[model samples]
Target: MEARLPYDDYPVVFLPPYESPPAWVPPHERLYHPDYNNELTQFLPRTVVLKKPPGAQLGFNIRGGKASQLGIFISKVIPDSDAHRAGLQEGDQVLSVNDVDFQDIEHSKAVEILKTAREITMRVRYFPYNYQRQKERTVH
Candidate 1:
């Protein structure tokens, strides 16, 4: 008697081997692709300018820390909001807002500065996944 394997009667289809995508492709576009490795080493820090009309929410949260610590980090970005549309992401360390350095500023003062501005320009650095992982390992 011959042994029967499951789905043996079905026709076989083979696919080509996967190749890594070019580094220039935006991170959002690479998501879900089989060859995407989530490496953003080549990504450079950029400034994002967002102009919010009166009564428009900034759509993000900020956490204030000591003056000696690093700049305030973007804790959260609400989806489909002004911040999200402006490409704001969690873990972005903010360097400045509208040409003002808030690195050592008080949290409330920073919040006030952002609150009064209709046009906000933020310089942020996005820490890559590998870098963040390494930071965590060293912290512990």
Candidate 2:
């Protein structure tokens, strides 16, 4: 039989079989916080929506939807664009798109609905905050 060293007298050491500490982790596609993408402020839409599909990788969730309201809003309607021609105004709070309430839907699901909708009828609360309409603001 092999002899065993005394617990107190043995030399304290980490075995070589163990892996070394990680220096850096490889970057991967991942959700930053709150929602899946990085900046919510950048992606924040006046309209919110929910959607589901069997082939979809992510489960049902909410995402930025088509603009419901139009000016000095969190979501801006591009000038002379489809959204702009649709009578959508800035600072409009989107209650729903295609009559679907999107208060708490997930991001992935929202994308699906927006993509699939043929004729979207968005219900909006316009200019509740009294923000002035302006040209598109640029992020510096």
Candidate 3:
């Protein structure tokens, strides 16, 4: 038998015994708390600015952003290219391009956005696991 909390219907937010979430904390929002996950720092989001001269390529290929794969992701980072130099890596999820959210964007639309942006400020995070767990959470 499982032990019941004082409020069984409400979920509990459990952090490490030594650490506590600052101020008021909600169970669903614990993920946004910096100290909530030990792996947060390891998968920190980083910003990359890319400028491509006319008739030049940005040096990266993107994949995903379909029903099967819901987020735009970096599939390749060509060596010696600007993307590689900026530390872009394969499997990096493109959170946004020019500040436009790309997480649930369409494949063709994402391509068009990137191609049209002469200089793009991309916010991405490297999630080695591809963040399937988070996707599953959002589905419900």
lDDT for each candidate structure = 0.73, 0.45, 0.79
Per-residue lDDT of model 2, residues 70-123, tens digit only: 211325555765566555555565556686665444434555555677555555
Per-prediction TM-score to the true structure, in the order listed: 0.60, 0.37, 0.63
Of candidate 3, the 10-residue stretch with the lowest lDDT total is 131-140
Q: Which stretches of candidate 2 lie over 4 Å from their true place?
A: 1-74, 127-140
RMSD of each: 15.0, 19.0, 11.4
Better of 1 and 2 by lDDT: 1
lDDT of 1 by residue, 1-140 (tens): 99877797878998756878565756777777666766674356778898879887889987643442555667779999889988888877677999988677777788888888999999887754433433333321
Instruction: Specify the poorest-scoring 10-residue window by lDDT in model 1.
Output: 131-140
Order the candidates by lDDT, highest first: 3, 1, 2
RMSD of 3: 11.4
Error of 2 at 16 (Å): 55
Question: What lDDT would candidate 3 get against the real structure?
Answer: 0.79
